[model samples]
Target: MKLALFADGHVGTQIADWLLQHYADDLCLVVTTQENSITEAAKQHDVPAVAFRSEQQVLDFAGTRSIAPDLGILAWWPQLIRQAFLDFPRHGFINTHPSLLPFNRGKHYNFWAIVEKAPFGVTLHMVEQGVDNGDIVAQRQIAYDWEDNGESLFHRAQSTMLDLFRETYPKIRSLQFARTPQDLSKGSFHHSSELEPASQVFLKQTYQAEELLNRLRARTFDEHPSCWFEADGTKYEVRINIRKADS
Candidate 1:
């Protein structure tokens, strides 16, 4: 049950802490990107920690240290892991994605789910070379109301991810799980740049109120760029706050 963890961000840090609490003895290495809370958490737990800018660096470091882990877990890790690294772990690699695969396979999956009206959820899957196009190990659907925006959806997905990991980690540890291949024909993948053009809310274009509302909700991430449109050479970003009317 030796584990190698690669993760980033607040949710990543939380997952790392939980793993340390539950499987401290099995944790072999904690790998993070740059100096973040994940790195700090590893230090707090006194777990061996390292930071790598790319997948190659991780592979190189692990090779140099002769570190061989039974399982590699990726929580909110942004880098693209290749086959070499995937094979480094005895049981291969597992990752938690914000959306159910093979839908919303790329960046900003939470935002894309709302914008595309796709099934919103979280997925734990066996990592392959392709981006999020992997065999599903476990998944859980997240519920959202009209009041939910991109940031809220992200938080919900993050919570679901942790829960899914907790539920599935035991099965994985015992090697008592089945691999479910994703239905490639049933899902869609998008790149980060693909959403940029659609994120613009054109004032001159006649869009339905619902469409505009969905756009605003999808793009409303905290401290991040929101949906915008230019008018009279002036750009304006739009944010939506939705709530049910008083009964």
Candidate 2:
């Protein structure tokens, strides 16, 4: 099985390591967002590694190959994968997205799930032209509590995503997984730019208590910028921590 891995971050590194160990001969190329562990592992094994900046680069590389890869895996990939690259992989690419597909299709899935009070989960799906609009290969719906802030949900989703990938590997290898086309109408889509505007707490505008809490908690990832409000000439960031009172 000739394979190409387009990956990033911890899950990406883990995938690369597993492939290098179990399917070294089958791996043709490793495409990473930057010089990370994925590239480093590929380097150690002398596998071809590239940080592709454009769709044309991927096309050119595929053109050089006599036979396209059997499959490609996109784990935590950042950019939108174009059709040219999608077509190069024989069985098409499978993406490990953090959100339950169709819903929260683009960026900030963790944050949106909380803000919108939508279904929160992880999905492994076939990569189509659109952002996370793909046939579902596998999915795991996660339930979040009021205690689940953006940071908690983010880590939880990542953990679940990796687990789903591991459990689904055998099916993927055998090409036995089902591709159920997502119902495009049922879920929501968001852009990366939408997050900032959504995160703005309007100081003057009245909001329901629940609505205000949801907005604050959704953006409450301590590692990143939190929800903010403008006061006079200055801006103030706010975050919340929810816990049950002990009896």
Candidate 3:
């Protein structure tokens, strides 16, 4: 039941802490980007941690340590793992994605889900070379009302993903689980650049209120770029604060 973990960012830190607390004995190595909270968290647990910038570095670290992990877990990792490293683990790899795959398969999935009106959810799947095109292990749909926005949806997906891991880890540990192949025809994948055009709002043109609102909500990640429009050579960023109406 030995495991290797690859992750970064806030969700990654939380997953790392959970692994340390619950599966300390089984964790063999942890990989994260350099100079981040996730790296610090792993070190605090006294786990063998490496900050890798590329796939080659990961291979080098494993070779140096003479470590062969039984399973590899990817939580909030931003890079594409090479097949050679994917094969290093005895049981291959599993990843957590913030949307119901084969929909919203790439970056900013939470934003794309709302904008496209796709099935909003989180997915745990077996990792293959294709981006998020993997066999599904488990998934759960998240509900959102009119009050929900990009920031709120992102947080909800993060929490649900963690919960899914907690619920499914036992079965994975025992190697007693089923894998469901995703129906590729049923959904779509978006590249990082695909989201660019959606981020721009045209103020001069008449747009449906719902469409305008969805765009505002989709692009409104905290500290990231906001939905914007240019009017009279002046650019304006849009933010929404929705509340339930009195019954």
Q: Model 3 over residues 97-165: C-alpha lDDT tens digits?
A: 999888888888877887888888899999999899989999999988778888988999999999999
In model 3, which residue pairs have backbone atoms overlapping below 3 Å? Answer: none
- Winner on lDDT between 2 and 3 is 2
Instruction: Tell me each candidate's TM-score.
Output: 0.93, 0.93, 0.93
Identify the runs in model 3 with alpha carbons over 4 angstroms from their true place.
Answer: 35-46
Off by over 4 Å in 2: 62-67
The true-versus-predicted C-alpha distance at residue 56 of model 2, in Å, is: 3.1
Could you give the candidate ranking by lDDT, starting with the highest?
2, 3, 1
lDDT of 2 by residue, 1-247 (tens): 7788888887788777887887788788888877777787898887888787777776676667654688999988877787766777888999999988878888999888888899999999999887888899999999989888999989998889888988898888778899999999998998889999999988789999988999899999877899999998899999999987889
Best by lDDT: 2
TM-score of model 3 vs. true structure: 0.93
